[model samples]
Target: MMTQGTLVDATIIEAPSSTKNKEQQRDPEMHQTKKGNQWHFGMKAHIGVDAKSGLTHSLVTTAANEHDLNQLGNLLHGEEQFVSADAGYQGAPQREELAEVDVDWLIAERPAR
Candidate 1:
């Protein structure tokens, strides 16, 4: 339901972060790629999930190095409640994109690590 004067939107964005694999391995997940001895790939699949019902609405996948704000507009459309993301999404443009759509782009605050 659309609010009296509020806007709704939705989108899929990729949050790319590289994490070192703690486990030892010989063969990589894919043989076509190689990096010295142990092949590694960093990837983060950003998905749009329903905030109210806690359901995934859509998804966007990209390389681990891809920027989260790079694909913000891809998911903008009518009927979006809001956007929720991890600290990796704490960027400037992301909030602006959602603002253009008149939607609340909520970012999960990360504790100082």
Candidate 2:
């Protein structure tokens, strides 16, 4: 069976920071990022899912502050006919990377005020 498309996105997972001890104070692999007025500390999981069947096809974990587009290349399976991503994955650099491949890129349009 031929794979239809790949849906790409990322989500942050918060790390617990309840202890005062140096080693327990924070997770070494996790980091912080500010979105709007809130600051979050944790890691981000970048994922790609099959658009037609809703099955996960790829996953990559990175520090919280890592940008979403940085993991785009790793999420592609080379079998997808197209790729769909969010606004966070838009821009020239990302487009250039996609240009190297033969799949169609479907990036969401960012709302303008």
For candidate 2, lDDT tens digit of each residue in 26-94?
566788898769998888999999999898989999999999988898998888898898888777234
Candidate 1 lDDT over 1-113, as tens digits, reads 33222111222222222322567442232122132374335443555545566455456655544565665656443476565566556663346554556556576676876
Backbone clash tally (model 2): 0
Judge candidate 2 at residue 77 and give its lDDT: 89
Evaluate residue 17 in candidate 2 and report its C-alpha lDDT on the 0 to 100 scale. 47
TM agreement with the true structure for every prediction: 0.50, 0.85
Instruction: Give the 10-residue window scoring lowest on summed lDDT in candidate 1.
Output: 3-12
Q: Candidate 2 — which pairs collide?
A: none
Off by over 4 Å in 2: 18-25, 92-97
What residue pairs are clashing in model 1?
Answer: 8-80, 9-80, 10-75, 11-75
Where does model 1 exceed 4 Å of error? 1-42, 92-99
